[model samples]
Target: MNGATTSGELRAHNRVRLLRAVHDGGATSTRSHLTRELRLARGTASVLVAGLAEDELLHEEPAQEHGRGRPTQVPGPHPRGPLALAADVREDAWELAACELGGRVTVLDVRPHDGTAEGALVPLGETIAAHTSRLGHRVIGVGVALAGPVRFGGLADIAHLGWRSVDVPALLGLPLRPAHGAGGGGATLGNDTAFAALAEARRGRLRDVRVGLHLHVDFDLGGVLVVDGRPLGGASGTGAEFGHMPLEGGDRPCMCGATGCWGMDVGANALLRHAGLEYGGGRGREQAERVLATSEQAVAACAAALGRGVAALVNAHDPEVVTLSGHGPELAERAGETLLRACEPRLMAIRRDHPPRIEGSALGWRGALLGAMESVFDVFLTPEGLGRWRDNHPDQGRDTPGRRNVTHSTPKGDQPP
Candidate 1:
């Protein structure tokens, strides 16, 4: 049998808990707020904050007085705290961002892509390298959100982009620099739609939801199931292919090697097809945007198909709500009533009266990037990782082997550098 927990272990656990509370609460989190949220005594919370500050993980500032209460310090990221780099790769564009601990994202770069996963690597690597060089040794890990099925640390297939069985980590060449903790940080990959679902669950509309669905309709429809604030990616990590479901009866073969895929009728390709524009690859999003801006009939068909697919998923999954991202929110805004009307005939009679609430994404275009940052934090914020970080930079002046001197600077906005 194992021995009972010691004071050191308990203190470490409480330290991680305090940091997590501050992280989840964002920049406005105060000492008193953390104390109440963690149900820790005021003195205990103070000690934890002091310890984190000493380790350069958090910074405290006098909070602005609001109502009648004693002044308290608001917690924020330390100047030398670890950072996360997030990348979102789409068909025509890619974005890279630097995210600090308190959830502040600074867009490092956004560049157009060649619509091919293999061709994207050179530029993607160059950009990541540039940012990592500038950010120095503070970057803890990288998270990538790809617009396709990711299987076992690689791309299973991106049908529209025509990529198959691509190794993403090999392509990106991760670990741009050494990490802060013992976990020896590298890169983490996820589906863009799943990452968006994670973003919604953590900081957006799905925060209050128990079971829900999130659909991001861009060049294609991609989504994930959010259960209890976690997006479930199945074995091999490419599970939630909700769009590939055969809800529409047709003979046309889908890019995903199936017939009558629901996605073929609900996204940019469908909208472009309805508008007599080209449907495959490259300019689908551009064409769909122009059509949605000019033509009403095309939008109507797309909206109807979108609603039908949503109804089918709802019937199968029984989620509490459905949140829309990418072009989904615009489609819902223009044809919400039509989408709801289309669902009425397909849903069960009991659900028809009280169907799942469909709403736009609160995080908007930044959902995937935010989720990518969250993924980085998820890997690095554990008790073991924190202990390693603390050990590497102990208060006693003896320099630890392999420890690099990380400089500090104030971050823009409320977050510390």
Candidate 2:
């Protein structure tokens, strides 16, 4: 706490800040705009951009002529800039996408499988290996969004797939070793709904909220509470399994070997069950949707159960807003009032008068996909991370964030007389 901040450290911090601005802004920024946003001098901003351009982290081009001021430079993700990779492992399918700094994602591949651990991860791993091999120089890391709780390092118990304590890492080894990433950190595992909630916090319905509740109701209900823009994973990172709670107090059995689970009364299973259809592991999704679309009574019952559980959560955590994802929007649209009525009576008196607003998902299915991408980007976009990358991949253009090689001094008439 005594020594002055090193110039190298200061430059590193500023460079990280600049990269973060573009990544979060989800679009390109001009030199003047970035300068204003980062509260840096025009000259300083230009220098930072140049260094980043030299490192191939950012691409610069002439700004289109529109204004009377001097021509500004536009900075965006370089063609060879670091990329964030994400995968979604569903009940019968898996998907992969590559994302640029500004959160623009391009889905690479999606393939269906036989619902086995190998059936899912094998094809998925192959796709990732093939893609990252060509894109390895830019890939930072990969994040996989699975349907069920992911605990420890390798064990995954996905009920739909009947995958119990599967060793995922053994099947899917290191995916990439991007030029910036030192041999990569392998795949990070996150629950699908939690990842969707993360996407919500970053760019969707839950964005900017202090405390938010995100519920995803597909074949079953699952959710996470986002506080300070993060999903609250418990001590073992195996928490926020809100679906297992029994708010309805029914004796219905659940797939998790528990009885009277709140999940048994909502999601696609609930809709299908109410319609007198046998709901089995992700197979009833389409049928459940059809039933909800045709049977008003089915939607009403499912929404009521959803409302009761939501009320319980609201009472326990007191979120600012509750946003729904997966198939929740369609259900809410049909039975919104019924859901509200069930929620209203259950709330404690204080929350009754002024209740939290329940809204639909803004990003829809894209939430999970984008969340997976952001999860990995969150790791590699740090100042320390960027510094390590710049160091490992030296020979970058002229100036580096950790070193001062470019002259900052501008001649007297260089101010654009």
Candidate 3:
């Protein structure tokens, strides 16, 4: 039999559990609530909170007394706690945000960029550097959501932007600063649609789903399969290329070098095409809105295609739920019945009796940014990571924002290799 758990080991485990509870609870988590949620005795909860407070991972303030009950303390992220920087790179624009432990994101910057993928990196790097300089040692990691298929830690293709087999790290100048985990706070890059799906799984409508699919209809339709609250990636880390699949039989060649790609008939570009407007990267969204405002026929056609493709995917994946992000929610609202009708014919007869629940995403366009923060926090909020954080702040009494000093150390066995 294994030996009894040591005090240090137990403390480490409690720290991880407490931090996770606070993170999942958002800004409303209180010390009393954590005690109940983690099922920890009052004394144990006090010890964990004290330890975390000393390490500057979290802090507490007295909650507002609403009724006759005694006032309790509300737990929140330490003002000096580590922040995760998130970047969302779209076809013609990009945004960066700073995320706290409780999922509160503050937009650091948003800027439109030229369609040239290589040239856009200069400004992107500059913006990241500027933000890092302001946050100093509080930055834990950087997570980037790219609007393309990511393979081998780089972009495999983004035809709308004319990018193919691009080295993302080299382009974005990763490792902009030192971080808690390995590789020196190196950036984690993922497909935007995949990350958005991850966001839905964690905190959106798909939270209750065991198996689900999430689609984001932006300039084009892109999505991923979520299993067990995680987005599934293939061997090349780009398996969720649902948009590239051929669902609409046609002779029109797609930017992905395919004929009849489902995305060609289902996204903003598709809507623009139905409106008799030429495809334009920067103007696709605008033209789609214009079409939706004026033409019912275009909306019905796009919604039908969207539903038909979703039915095909549902047949293949057999998901319990389907969530839409980006412009998908709007499109669904306008053509809900029409979309459902289209799905009925395409779905198997048995599935037609009880189809999956389709709904709009709660995170909206913020899904990718929120998911990026999730990627970083997954690295930072572990037992080993908390231990390292404690070790770095040897003088636990120092509570000021700029007083702490960070040092690099090899990650422990519990950490990702």
The alpha-carbon lDDT assigned to residue 65 of candidate 2 equals 89
283-336: candidate 1 lDDT, tens digit per residue: 667778988777778778878888888888888889999999988998888877
Q: Which of candidates 1 and 2 reaches a greater TM-score?
A: 1
What is candidate 2's lDDT per residue for 337-366, written digit by digit as tens?
999989999999988877998999988877
Candidate 2 TM-score, true structure as reference:
0.88
lDDT assessment of candidate 1: 0.79
Per-candidate Cα lDDT values, in order, are: 0.79, 0.79, 0.80
Location of the lowest summed lDDT over 10 successive residues in candidate 2: 408-417
- Highest-lDDT candidate: 3
Model 3: residues with Cα > 4 Å off, grouped in runs: 1-5, 176-184, 280-282, 393-395, 399-417
Q: Give the distance in Å from residue 291's predicted Cα in candidate 2 to where it truly belongs.
A: 2.2
**Minimal lDDT window, size 10, model 3:** 408-417
Model 2 pairs whose backbones collide: none
